[model samples]
Target: MTGGPATPPTPRPPLGPELEVRRLGRFDYARARDLQQELVAQRAAGEVCDQLLLLEHPEVVTLGRRTPEGAADGLDLPLVEIERGGEATWHGPGQLVAYPLFLLPLGRRDLHAYLRDLEEVVLRTLADLGVEGERREGLTGVWAGGHKVCSIGVAVRRWVTWHGLALNVSNDLAGFERFRPCGLEPGVMGRVADLAEVPADDPLLEAHLERHVRGVFGHR
Candidate 1:
């Protein structure tokens, strides 16, 4: 291979940032929360490196830390209170949920920037799937054609972040129609299947998202 002038390689995130990924097909909400609690403690105590949990819940609605009053008044699903900061969102089959039990980057402990990074991951993933995903002003999740395809509600404890992002691949949208997520109007959620011609298998998408996230964070 010959070149007139060699192009400089692109700079990547610092390597060797340990990341553990767990993919449980269709897991429980409460149990996953408990597992996150355990991992957070372990991570803070130096017992574990950065960890990422990827799974889909069986139709559950989580009330975020900033969710408004009566946000989920009449939902027929279990209402779980979590430490994440955002409004309510739904998790169910066909969506990809990722919780990164990570140690915030040294000297750059900015939560807002981290949230934007999460959005970039989802957007890139969508791009790889032949879909164009963008960000909406005054919103935290990734959007496509003015509809939300991914929802992010993050919470940090001792600079260790948890409660990550969820991307809709092919989930049943009826659940989202039941509530106003993030104080946004109802019926504004979307899925990758809606925009892509490829198959929206959860496991396949989960694997792809994991790869995208690993590269985005540059965790070894």
Candidate 2:
């Protein structure tokens, strides 16, 4: 008897440049920012491939380009002023932060498109974990169950991108109460663990994220 029609081979994700994925557990915010700067320079010089640094930070509040002066004046958390495009935001132990040090080619250099691709990567990863994520109109993050679950802020230098999105895994949401995050009310922040059972440092979640990044950003 003839066998049933064979299934088509799984189509591979489209490839662009190579990406090196690194996992740095509980890194300091300042150090991480410095590292991104160093990598950006190297990537721009054609001395390194694309890089995706995934990690968590201790309790900290960061001010972006849109943050007004003194926006974080009273926050007890460590405050950092950064060059990324966004407002004030928080990062802590239970959050997963990703910094993509990529030297964008001519085709992928559109800042708006890059932001959307980052959102798409998060949406796909959340779907894999059984959570539905959507983008709000005029907002640049992933929300679920009517609350913001991801915050994205990025900067590009010499066409190289750095500083990226933060996903709340099992992080302490209470920290958000001390200050406005992403220019939204503190109550707007949400955690993935609230909707599903996943650790902040889950390896499987990181793997899913890597796959999504590769697919969405066209990195091999």
lDDT of 2: 0.83
Model 2: residues with Cα > 4 Å off, grouped in runs: 1-15, 199-204
lDDT of 1 at 115: 76
Q: lDDT of all predictions, in order shown?
A: 0.79, 0.83
Alpha-carbon shift of residue 167 in model 1 (angstroms): 0.6
Q: 107-219, model 2: which lDDT tens digit per residue?
A: 56667777777888888988987999887767888899889999999999999999999998888899899778888899999988888777445643677788899987778
- Candidate 2, poorest ten consecutive residues by summed lDDT: 1-10
**Which is the leading candidate under TM-score?**
2
Q: What TM-score does candidate 1 reach?
A: 0.90
Pairs of colliding residues, candidate 2: none
TM-score of each prediction:
0.90, 0.90
